[model samples]
Target chain A: MIEIKGLVVRYKTVEFKFDDYKFKKNMISIISGRNGTGKTTLLKSLSSLIEYEGNIKVNGEITYNSQEPILFNRSTYENIVYPLRIRNLDLNLYKEKIDKYTRVLSIDHLLNENALKLSSGEKMKVSIIRSIIFNPDIVLLDEPTTHLDLESIVELTTLIKELKNELTFIIVSHNSSFVEELKDEEYRLGGNHVYS
Target chain B: MIIESTMKAVELLFSFDSEIYTIIFLSLAISLLATATASFFGTILGILISISDFKLKRFTKKIVFTFMGIPPVVMGLVVLLLITGPFDGMNLLFTKSAMYIAQTLLVLPIIVGNIIISSEKTQKKILETATTLGANKYHKITLLIKEIKPFILMSVILGFSRALSEVGAVMLVGGNIKNDTRVMTTYIALNNSMGEYSMSIAMGIILLLIAFVLHTLLARFRGDFYD
Candidate 1:
């Protein structure tokens, strides 16, 4: 579970104050707003990627995958397996999970291809798979649907729904259809204040 | 005269004339070691400064840029004073070690400055992304080093070029002593001053050859990483 109190994020001349809220474990929560409405800012603050004033209490591990998706200059398989390798986890233990995710995303064949050569949508898929492969307690995804096509978006939405039972998700997206499909708690932000 | 010198330069290169070979080897050994040492430590300092945010950040960059433009003659003089000061009794002056120290000091800023610029270009996104992914400081630094390796390679090569082609600093610090401290650049200057045009021109050709080889290697390395 994640709890927030008096969350205030300040940038140059603007400020955003989020209402106190609690996000239950093993659920999908969507934060939606128009462009430049601080949707990404709020998500970043929650993930502790940006500086914020307030208290955020998170129960377990959390990881964030940005919208732009940073990919290493290596093969896709290497990029996906990087976090595990760095953390010294046994690759054999995650082989089944890797197979399932890659097969679902239809990226198993492209695993050996150079990640830098991948198109934006394909790179986004690779990044998403890489981020969640470790199975953190909470995942913050910012604009995950930006480069994804209709088909990939549907596939990702399905995957998120299935995984929500095992971990928590805090997503920032402008896609109404994607939001409608998940149908979890929603927080709408406007200027300096947020509404639930 | 030009044709004769060119032929002599070719013969000296092919036959590996002992005197010329010794000079080339000394020059290469000193310059390569200086470049390697400077690149190892200087680039680490540069990468650390670039990734960090602190109050003195702008001031530190300004200082590095200023040092990058430092005159070689002035650097040589500074080094000469240091060696001839408390360490005067050590007899480091007119020695290859003195030249190595001078050249290292002269090229360190070049290596560090280029690293700072390249790290600014490449490490920002990677650093931020790594932070978001819950990477610790060590992991982030390692990832950053791996990512900007090509730029680092370019910087080290540039430093070597500077060290190899340097004349003013090495001459002042090394005194261009015969056989023991003579390097390619100093040898060329000495021969030219003595009106030994053929030998000077030969050394010039050898220097050009060295530069060409370095550039070709850098190009091949870039291809492997970039492609």
Candidate 2:
């Protein structure tokens, strides 16, 4: 579980304000907002990537995936293994899991290819898989479906559903359908909340 | 006349003039050393400046940017006076060491400025992701550097090329001493003055070739994570 209070982000002359909120464990929370409305910034603040004036009380580790996938020049497999290596997790223990996820995402074939050469959708899948492999208590994804096609998006949504029981997911998306499919509760920014 | 000189320059290179070869070798060795030293320190400083939030960051950045425009001759003169006066005990004045110092000063600002710009552009997203993941300071820095390695290399190579082709500052400090501090540019100048135009042209050709080869090699050496 995670609780956020008085989260205010100041950038130059503009400021983004977030009301107090609580994110329940094992539930999906989707934040929907327009462009330049601080959706990405709020996500980044939660990730500790940006400075914010707020109080965040959390009990478990957090993993963040950015809006644009950050890829290394190595193979897809190496990219997926990076977080594990950083956390010093046993590679052998996660090998099967990695293979399984890759197969599920249909990226197993691209495992040995240079990650930079992958298509945008493929890269996003790899980034998602890499973040999931870390097994954080909460995974914050900033527009995870941006570059994915319809087919891949469905597959990814399914993957998220499968992992929903094991990890909490907080996703920032502009797509109402995508949010509707995953969100247990939704936060609509820019005005008072009106559920559709 | 230019075409004739260029043709003669090619002939001189083919003939393998010993003096030209020595100058070419010295220029490569000294500039490479200077580039390596400056780039290492510059990149570190750039990253620190980019990541840290401080009141004086803007001021410091402005100063570094200003330093980038410092004329080589003026810089050489400043270095010359410093070495000959307050730093006289070091006896680096009019020596190869003085040349190295001048070249490094000229290139350091450029390298740092470029790297800082590149690092600052990408650091926010990267830092946020890393920090949220419970990554330590060391891990965050390592990841940042790995991500920016390509831009850093570009900055370093730019600095190297700048330092290698420089003449005024090195000449003022190195004194163009024969068989000693004389680099390619200085040697070419000396040869031209002595009516050895062919030898000077040959040195020029060699310098151009070296630059081309270095650029090609750097382009071919893929970055750690360039996607």
DockQ, prediction 1: 0.65
lDDT of each: 0.87, 0.84
- Per-candidate DockQ versus the true complex? 0.65, 0.47
lDDT of 1 by residue, B82-139 (tens): 9999889989999989999999998899988998998998887887777766678999
**What tens digits encode model 1's per-residue C-alpha lDDT throughout A52-117?**
999999899888888998898889998898888778899999999898888888798998999988
Q: Model 2 clash pairs? A: A49-B128, A73-B225
Kindly list the interface RMSD, in angstroms, of each predicted candidate in the order they appear. 1.4, 2.4
Alpha-carbon shift of residue A120 in model 1 (angstroms): 0.8
* Candidate 2 to truth, TM: 0.88
Docking class of 1: medium
C-alpha positional error of residue B29 in candidate 1 after TM-score superposition, expressed in Å? 0.5
The DockQ of predicted model 2 stands at: 0.47
Please provide, for model 2 over A83-167, each residue's C-alpha lDDT reduced to its tens digit, 9 standing for 90 to 100: 8888898999999999889888889999999888999999999989988897889999989989988888888888899999999
